[model samples]
Target: MEPQWVPSAADIAGARVTDFATFVTARTGESFPDYQSLWQWSVDNVAGFWGALWDYFELGERSGAVLVSTEMPGTKWFPAQQLNYVEQVVRQARTDRPAILGVDEDGSVIELSWAELLGGTAAFARALRELGVGRGDRVAGYLPNIPHAVIAFLATASIGAVWSACGQDYSAQAALDRLGQLEPKVLVTADGYRFGGKTHDKTADIAALRAGLPSLAVTVLVSRIGGTLPDVLAWDELLAAPGGQIDIAPVDFEHPLWVLYSSGTTGKPKGIVHGHGGVLLEHLKAVALQSDIGRDDTFFWYTSPSWMMWNFQVAGLLTGATIVTYDGSPSTPTPDALWAIAARTGATVVGTSPGYVLACAKAGVVPRRDHDLSALRMVGITGSSLPPSSSLWLRDNVGEHIPVASISGGTDVVSAFIGGVRTVPVWPGELSAPYLGVALDAWDEKGHPVRGAVGELVITKPMPSMPVRFWDDEDGSRYHDAYFDMYPGVWRHGDWITVNDHGSITVHGRSDSTLNRHGIRMGSADIYQVVEALPEVAEALVLGIELPEGRYWMPLFVVPAAGVELTDEVKARINTAIRAEVSPRHVPDEIITAPGIPHTRTGKKLEVPLKKLFQGAELSRVVAPTAVDDPALLTWYAQHTPPN
Candidate 1:
């Protein structure tokens, strides 16, 4: 498809990325004619580009030489530098500005100013100190997306203690699988949380988590609805404690700052560690330069702390943007609840997921008609690939001129590899461009770069935001095997992707989730795009099941929309659409009616996990039942037989 939205001259000139070009010209006495050229310069001249970003963001006092070795994993990056992630974020806080804003599922609101945030962190840091928590100690949060959670994270980072959090919605076992890996010294949590207008007390679940982690020394509780824990510090008490001030002590550049978990669809979640300096620099570029967020911008992203978007959402503060977080049912009192929050907050850049957009589309919820989204210019969507119709739905229903930027990255990097570029036109259902400083390309199984064809998404170069290390993989063998084992030295991010000549990208799905029909490779997303486009289909999951004697079957399981049965006509329509829209070879061998498609809590279809289940493997070995939204549905996959 030809690009539908192009930046006007004013739009191009006013962009931060354009300012970056001017900044480069002034600093290096070189002129970049366009955004892509500047991006190329950023890739080709990593030292100059990253070093300039460090100076531009004023990250910290530069002591060590930048880019000591240009190697992949062993890059001697700022070996002598010292910084703290919290100090870099909090230093930008203006006492007059609101630093954090939150809304509950019950429509309750919470706001914290920069001064209050500073004071709250100081007090919480004192409490952590009292608990004997110090630099390099682990701190964890099992809380909702509330102001207190943000304050607690800031406090943990303030004390140089590593911070990791799982939102209260996670199942107890899933919580154990992730937080158990860290063995945090201090665990901050809420008594309960509200979702879909109902309160779920987390007391028992919290006890289960406590029982699993033997290293936990202190438990702090924030009563959201209202509850008390014996012998536990209240969140208010921690904030109102008598103690005093906190000056963030600078840690080494490579010191482990925080741990983020990889989606453990296959096995135990790998604790991917990132350092203070690397995250600071990467976030500044991503938030300020990539998304065009600034002091005047209100950045809102709907995410649980379990997802990396929560980390990115809070990092918006590093760019002086007020970070607005929502923790509750996106559609409760009304289907337009999230848009109402965006309107109330005057959000400039609204971050969301594709599933949410599709839900709104299916429900006929129109933001432009029901809400005052005058301040909204950008709607950023991630989590999964967006179909072309849904991309157009934003234009037709939300705002004709608004750019709905599709972003793709994961917990692996904790930052986007492919996303929108304000300087370029955004093609519908396509990413605007590759993220600057990321050498992203599509590659075939033979390790050759391929464009305009779906192939393995590979990172040709190392990124600063790449994990500092996996938590327990001491010899780095697991890390190497996870990314580099397939293609030696290069980072094969296990997603199927295609890059067009215009630099726009279409991410199909996970490479592991790709369906192999005979010898042809197909993305499950391709089947979904064709099947879900039919009015009778609500959602779909497709996987090629390999059987004994090299037998194979591709089954398409779909959740039919209300009043729409999986009749013969619908089946024929699906087959015809697949054969027409995709290809004759891309049609599934079987069509089955599924009551509901199973997904991870984060809105990803459980294709790969289900494939393993149908292949006669034990359910537990395939995926953590707690990680899935519907464990019962997963078991049903193994029980149901496809048509002969």
Candidate 2:
């Protein structure tokens, strides 16, 4: 495929990656003519590349080895480095620019300066200390994507306490399933949050959530939308405490900075722990170099606290970029709400999901035409694969010059393996390149690398951002079995990918939810790309189920477009398109009209869980109700199971 957009000479010269290349050449006496060569050298000389980054970023002196071990799940990075995540962020603080921009659905905006941010963080840190929260203690937040959430997280990090959060959208039971694992000593929550022009009172839910977490010593509540809870400390009061000099507690390189949870589609969500030093280094590389964001840039990603993108967006602060937090629905009052937020905030780099882009496309919403998005340098998409049609739509509607960076990684690493490179050409529906130091490749079942064909996405080398450990997994058995069990020592990320000859990657979908038919394995994303592209289809879910006697049942569930009926003609067109675009053998056994498709809170399709539901598994056993976007959809899917 031809490149949709290529970097101009000026763009290349101005990018941070180019400067880093020059720095690398000066240090190693090696010249990298292009990104591919640079990436190869980075993976080959992991220690040298990481050490160079430490020096390049001026992340203080490194006393010990850059990399102590190379073993998967055991790799030790910056073994002797004692640093604080908040310290790195504070180093970038400037008085002239705001540190954060908080926006709401009502178009209200709040600007937090670096001095005020540090002061608030200091106050909250002192309060946390008073509450007996110390190093390694988990501080959980049941809050929305607001400035206070950022303040609370920074405060937790400043005190060397591990922070974990769930969006206020989750039910109390759902919050308990994830946050209860931490047994946090301090819980920061909001009485309510605004979304879709409505106030959702979470005070009752917060009370229930607090009741379940027996380890909680104190609950601090932010009174959003005029809701109130009894016996909880007010957010204002917490920040009103006597502010002193910000105290950034130095911790070990592997000290847990925060705990992120996996989508508990199968069982209890696993608390994925990441360290302070690793996150600091990786984010500086990701936000500054690959995405080309810097001091003057205002970065905004439409994400809730539950998603890793929120964590990634917080990393923008590490680069001295002002970050924007939106605490409202993406489509509330208008389909272009997020675009408007980006424009109003003057966000240079805006990130959203593919679903939102496609929804905008279907709604005929041209962001550039409707909103003043001239400040946008890049539009990032993640959470799932970006269909080719959606990518093209963004190029035509958003801006031809602004690259649509379709990044694919997961909460597992809290960072991307392959994503945007400012100096690279933007290919429709493909990530620009494997991120520097990420030894990413597509390998067959036999462990041989393959190109132009779908294979398992594996990381052959250690990344600084890979999880330091899993909470409560003392023996390391669970962590080992999660990634390394598939390919011993190699991180087997459970996604199908195709690395084309041009070095771009296309993530198909989850390998565990693959659609296999007649000895051919296909990704569910392939079907959605073709089926959902049709004007009549709003969303699609394809399932490939193994039946008795080697027989297979493949069903395609679709949510029809608004005011459109799923007649025989629509089904026929879908079948013909699948037959031509995909394969005849992979066509669904039947086309079923559904009310809606279920997704996780972070906007991932519930493919594996729904497949388990159709395969006669009990609803309670297959998936937790609160984990889904609409729990009723699970019962509806269970009722519509295919016949034997």
lDDT values for all models: 0.81, 0.86
TM-score of 1: 0.82
Clashing pairs counted in every model = 0, 0
Query: Which regions of candidate 2 fall more than 4 Å away from where they truly are?
Result: 513-644
lDDT of 1 at 341: 89
Q: Write the per-residue lDDT of candidate 2 for residues 1-644, one digit (tens) a residue.
A: 89998999999888899999999999889998889999999999999999999999998887989988888879998887899989888899799899999998999999999998889999999999988999989999999999999999999999899999988766676678789998999899998888888878887888889999999888998888788778788889888866767888999988999999876533567889999988888888988998989998999998888878899999999989999999888888898888889889999999987667867887999898999998898998887677777788888998999998878887888888999898899888888899999999999999999999989999999998899999889999999998999799999988889998889998866666756443233456656767899999999888876543224578999999999999999999999987655445447999999999999999889888877666666889978989989988887888885676
- Which is the leading candidate under TM-score? 2
lDDT of 1 by residue, 153-250 (tens): 88888778899998776656667778899889989999988777778788888888899989999899998768767768888877775434566777
Could you tell me the lDDT of residue 456 within candidate 1? 91
